[model samples]
Target: MKAPPPNILFFLTDNQRNDLLGCAGNPIIKTPNIDRLAASGVRFENAFCTSPICAASRASYLTGTSEKRHRFTFLTSPLQSAYTDISYPATLKMAGYRTGLIGKFGIATNGIVPSLQDEDAVEKMFDVFDNYEHWTEEGYEIRQPDGSVRHLTDITGDKTINFLRTHQSDHPGQPFCLSVSFNAPHAQDNDPRCYIWPATEDHLYAETQIPEPFNAHPDFFRQLPKFLRETESRVRWQKRYATSEDYQRNMRGLYRMVSGVDRNIGRILGTMDQLSLSNNTVIIFASDHGMYYGDRGLSDCWQLNEQSIRIPLIILDPRADENNRGLIREELALNIDIAPTILELANLNVSDKMQGKSLVPLLEKKKVDWRKAFFCEHRFHRADIPKSEGVRTQRWKYIRYYEQQPVYEELYDLRNDPHESFNLAGDHRFSNHLKRLRRRCDKMSAECA
Candidate 1:
């Protein structure tokens, strides 16, 4: 008989920017474990999320499709049954792989939607599902069955370790796909203290000085459209970044939360090694979407800026050739590609309905034609955060706020202006280039829609 497929371990974090990792060039944030994982695996330098919001991007990652196809872009929207039937976890479970999910299952968890809260309806997709939502200031405690209360991150790590140990012991010969999602680094929206980390990590970045991003300059906020300047992003920015002391304290808290997550990752990796499962497992690490920590005078991630769209992507396939390991690919990878890549690694055929292409060729360092550009979108009922769409390529980015009273547009030449400090939409010198990109953007919007 043929050998069973490799076990899959996916680690997902919340509201983490692509640049936060030490391997990604942030000297301040010490993500040594994540850096080591990137060193042992293939890292994609330009991975992006199809949508910048939590629910939408998570849906895309599971279904291998865009928000337009899944129709879960808004807050409290539930994942449709039609797509859940073919989601990565559901399909893998159907194919005889024991599937498990832990931590923030953001999609469809909003209690406002009754159908989404149907336990029996959602639990059928995975063999072991432990769902937890955002932790508030008063509710961050998880009282264990043994009467021990622990930090949410520690509880999450304990549950994950238990799942791994149980999976190995109960089903030694069966392949398993486990997804561990962490809620750290994403601040508690309703709390005044905002970002929270474990007590042990309080001293992680005590002596570090955090530098302000280009977008944090007052001039950047002055240049934004009135609608955007008044959005919730700006509101949160005022709350968290109004003073230098506030900025330093909040930024350090955010980094501390990230380091706490990194420590948990170290524990998980150590457990895998102890179980002798490191060689036969494929580990992938990524974030649901990027976050803006005072970037563009914004504190959240709804805009079409690079800080919101780009995410860190690392894949470690134990079966990879020696030469292929420890390599970095500059290809454009999207969150939608995750499901397809997982299925490909499992030696299963990708569904025709899934729009994302497999990344196996890129992982193998084989020659293949890849996408030149990808589309991003954000839709919301609130008027402050206007519904928007854009197309981003290697050299150019074109965005359109279609819902604004007078349609707002932005054009950036990424090669020359990586920080997007200057907008060239009205410049006569780039009119022809702008026209071509506008046409491409419109075409892609319709195609993706």
Candidate 2:
């Protein structure tokens, strides 16, 4: 007998990177739940976001297209001219699964500088998030709640719990998809003090080792703009502490925030177990992109380096295949592939318009030529310069800004120059390599087009 479709509990985080989990090799940040997931599921060692900015990357994940295709480059607008384009979640509904979305939507795509962020614009972004109240048999309906909502992460989890509580057994054994997004550890207010994390130095144990290109970039501020001098928190913090005492304070707090969400995830997982959905369910945890945490002279997660583009992706589907349980795969994966993967998991029709290939075959141990370079892009400053894109192959990373920026090119040999301190774009020795990387950029742009 053919088995029923498996339920999908999709968890998404904002402004997150790949190094948070102990399983991902950061010893100090405690993410027992995320680590547990890593231990039990396949972890994509080379996963990447299609774009580093919040809105553009989130839109790419939703629409299953490249930034060039979706054209939702700015946060406020829908992709291109199509407001009703069938996003992956909406497509799940076509495949006979109920769907729900909660938490941060990364809707701020218009190049609105943070310094000039209008109060009204922030409210508008918040409104787009709650515009679609909930889904029903009739159709996706508009919605607004009268209850006081605080802390986007808490609200996101609560909504998921509420949806689960209300929709018990509504599927009549058919599978459902629940997209629960959290805004934790994203520095919501742009102020570290505004962070809700409770992890402190006294409670934290010894600092865990974090591997990086440079032991420390203490002089990061020397090259940064004056306004962004405070961006080099990592370097400043490093100089202040004699040992690893508070080295992990901010990081431990991030872990606590992740742990907060993980606890809720545990509850959600426990709910599935109670409902007897474990044997036929798929759970996924990933982020739109990563954060800098004061790395490379950057205050936030807007940079295009591996620190900002590399994100964590895990898939745990007991029904998909039992053979790869607790198995970790190092194959290159991109956010572009998420659409097809989800569609394949739901046994639904994957659109021809989708650019990513499914990981189902790879998960099943089937051989395929996956990818060597993970493509990523960003428009963080949204300055007069139009665009910037990056391509990271297994050994090297190349980045180019396409417009009026003063310094517009970068190339790094990940194996040797991990800090990306030296830009080789103008070097005669790497001219051939630069040509190759430029060709890659053109190819990716064409593919995305």
Question: Which predicted model would earn the best lDDT?
Answer: 1
- The numbered model that scores best in TM-score is 1
How many clashing residue pairs are found in candidate 1? 0
The local distance difference test score of each candidate is 0.85, 0.64
Query: At residue 216, what lDDT does model 1 achieve?
Result: 84
RMSD of each: 1.9, 7.1
- Candidate 2, after superposition: displacement of residue 207 in Å? 8.6
TM-score (all chains, Cα) for each model: 0.96, 0.81
Q: Give the Cα error of residue 280 in candidate 1, in Å.
A: 1.0
Candidate 2 per-residue lDDT, tens place, 66-151, comes to 77777665644444423224467667765667766666555444432321133343222221133221112212111237553244
Once superposed on the true structure, which residue ranges of model 1 sit more than 4 Å away at CA? 75-77, 109-121, 143-149
Residue 328, candidate 1: Cα error in Å is 0.9
